[model samples]
Target: MRSITRFITTSDIVRIALGWSAFGALLLATPLLSPPVPAPLLITALVSIVAVILVCAFGVVRQAEALARRLGDPYGSLVLTLSIVLIEVVLISAVMLGPGEHATIARDSVMAVSMIILNLVIGLALLLGGIRHRGLAHNRTGTSAYLAMLVVLIALAFGLPALIGQDGAYTTAQAIPVVIVTLALYGFFLFRQMGAQADDFTEIDERLTLRAITSTEPDAAAPGIRDVLREHRTEILTRLGLLVVTVIPIVLLSHDMAALLDDGLARLGAPTALAGVLIAAIVFLPESITAIRAALGGEVQRVINLCHGALVSTVGLTIPAVLIIGMPTGQAVILAETLPDLMLLTVTLLLSISTFAAKRVTAMHGAVHLALFAIYTIVLFS
Candidate 1:
């Protein structure tokens, strides 16, 4: 029994691999099975949600030690950004293709995107990071700059569409130009992140090391990247395999998940805004769990980077991808006036105020954010 207990080690990597395999199997088999609508849909949604969670867990564990080794501040941020936004894009695309007669699908999508980034992503990150680190000190200048750009982008991309209306004089020709320009601006931001400008925003110190947060043995020998990669070659390859396997399942499961959500919302007399919120939640689930864990473990830097990075990537990458795809298809992907949009905006404003008001986040703050999340859930269910 003791030996068996010892053998039952719960490694994050192992769990993630199993999850990816399960999701891949489900994705490949679901369509072939063609299960009934509501049941299949619910199952698909659950599977997708689980798959995302597993993928995130895999990313966190695989990257955690490595992130601590090199590029300390900015490491987890990229992983979070890439993973969350990719999930968001997949879910959004699936939903848009589903049979939802709502003409303002694009608007709701944007609103959902905004709320998830601000409230779920940022709020939870701050809450958890604050709780773990007595006070997580972020670069105020970077935070301010990000907030400013975010506000402007939201105003231009999300807020303006509601006022403009779907049938407004701005035809496809006019909209196409705006999207192209937005894409170009995003390109510039991407360039800056990968270039010298990033140096201005990111700072690193030995004090910011993971060793400072978690009670782990510090590696005395600092190995080179090549050596490290060689040592972990199998792990890295496993992660890559896991990522591909997991993503396919998410896409497949999302098809029915979208339909069931729409049906469930309709049957329950829920608001259209609920759809957007659901999409955001599904996509952000994995990242959210990672952030929470890091926060509890007192890794504030990872929390901040992951949360803020995800917010930026969602808007910068996922939103543009949707627009680009929508344009060629002649789909009106502009933000339109909707209750969900207002709710999303309100959540964002509230998050900005809460996070900025006190540079230090505590358990109490986490409770408040969680309370807000509860309220959101209640509103959706009600």
Candidate 2:
């Protein structure tokens, strides 16, 4: 009785209550969400869905980090980024297919993610980490490798379309080649990332080891070897189960969220781009939290890995997939950004190139990136 009571605190109960209530709301409200019922009700439902998504996503991030802790190094960062990117892809796909005028949603979401990671996540990570540690060091080769690939992929997937395509749009035939190129880039990177160049993604951080041990333990006292094994096995299984359980609702609720978002944004006369920003923000919440925590804990390289790796996956994998889907369905995949957005992207890439040029990062670098992010936010809403 003491153990059970100790395990279930007020915080745990609140989380459970909120999760279940959100699940119930989603199931009950999904039927009426289509065609978008009255505005007031729709707003309420939208708020509920978004709120639930944030909660569920938070749960997924916590579990994913638990899994990452056990896995270690490149694989740890890889798992976290892949999990978050999967959610991003699923959410964007749902929005694309749902009822509403969201033709450019995929493009907007992808671009939003790129900017958010490069500017917002990286900015905060570097700033806070530098402030805490004075400066942070990472594998320069690894950081450079990620940045090089990102520049190329971002250029091909986003910049090229604006420069050569018709009115910043890629036709089916044009898109086919771009899609192939992007996928090939991703495959090559994946091959090298997992094998020959794996070291490039790893960092020498003692903190990660300590963090993993603490997070994996279910109780305070140490156990016998056999008990330890059993506990480790139980922890892995529990995390895996929770990961799937939480992720499913996130995906399922996403469709409903997308519907509500599309209708609500249009009615409020919000910018179409704002829909993408909001969706990207939601999708990024988990990853942002994980990265920030890593930075604060002196695991700066992991922050770079998660933020940069996510950008690569977004452009390399998500963009290609979205384009492939759009080509067959005659949906126009808008890959180009407006002048201001493009300028921000260019500045971000340049700053990143300069920031990671060395193995060390300072507060000044972070401050510069944060300033760019500030400009980005102002322009986005203004």
Candidate 3:
């Protein structure tokens, strides 16, 4: 009874109430946002609402991470990835249907996420991890495989569309075949990840090579099996409940947030691409934190899986979703890339090949990636 009581605190109830209150605010404000509220007040209101939504998003990430810890690898990362992707899809769909009818939101946002994860986040992770530990090792086969798939998908989804399609934007007919092939490939990758090659994503520990390492020391105190099970069961249930509760408000509030975001970005005279980049940053925040911690903790393989897996999932799942919705509705799905952006992407992929070419990650490799990331950032803002 005491433990159960501890799980449901007054503070928790108050937070849930506040979340619902925010939802109510969304209902009242979104419909009336037209004619552009006075710039000052509009910006203020938009910033405040975004702040609240980000707080809610952070809560969801915390709970999701807790659930991940309880569940362990592959399943853990899978949960986090799916949750974020759902939010991304919701935001994109809402924006597409908005007054602006954002045709390029999906493409720009997915590209932004891929760049942030592949360059900014991964580069920082490896740079810091390398500086701290000199170098870290991960399963090369898994890392290389992830890089290979990433290159292929990026080319087929982003590159080929520009080369063969109408001004780089795929017509409905062009999109259909691309969607089918991408989905099929993703399905195959998922099976391999969860089944036959599951171990590939983990670190290869040399300690397991010796018989002495497998032998338990007599002086070591062993934990009780039942206690471990009970703890895990309790944690899983509690965190799962929190995850459900937190994610509900995110989905409920995201539509209004998307509407306001478009209004705000346009009002500020921001670049069109900036809108997608900002949205991608908000969505990727949780995973970015997780990847950083993993790298710092010397868990290079987990970092690879999280960063690389996110890019794969973002493209694999997101492009397909966009095409599926856009094609049927006669909505224009713009995926054309500027020549400079395409060049940046090409160089980034090449760096990835070099980074994962070996069994270990080094500071030099990290430095090179970070240099490319710096160039990408400069190009983005300049």
Candidate 3 ranges with C-alpha deviation above 4 Å: 1-20, 31-43, 97-100, 209-238, 248-269
Per-residue alpha-carbon lDDT of candidate 3 for residues 234-259, written as tens digits (9 for 90 to 100): 66666667665765665565545555
Per-prediction TM-score to the true structure, in the order listed: 0.71, 0.80, 0.82
Name every residue pair that clashes in candidate 1.
Answer: none
- Give candidate 1's total backbone clashes: 0
Off by over 4 Å in 1: 1-71, 90-103, 168-170, 199-255, 262-276, 343-347, 357-359, 364-368, 371-382
Winning candidate number (TM-score): 3
Better of 1 and 3 by lDDT: 3
Please report how far candidate 2 places residue 359 from its true position, in Å. 2.7
Candidate 1 whole-model C-alpha lDDT, 0 to 1: 0.57
lDDT of 2 by residue, 186-248 (tens): 889888877777777777554655777779666455333345346666566556556656655
Worst 10 residues of 2 by lDDT: 3-12
Clashes in predicted model 2: 0
lDDT of 1 by residue, 77-113 (tens): 5644575467666666765666654345555565565
Candidate structures ordered by TM-score, highest first: 3, 2, 1
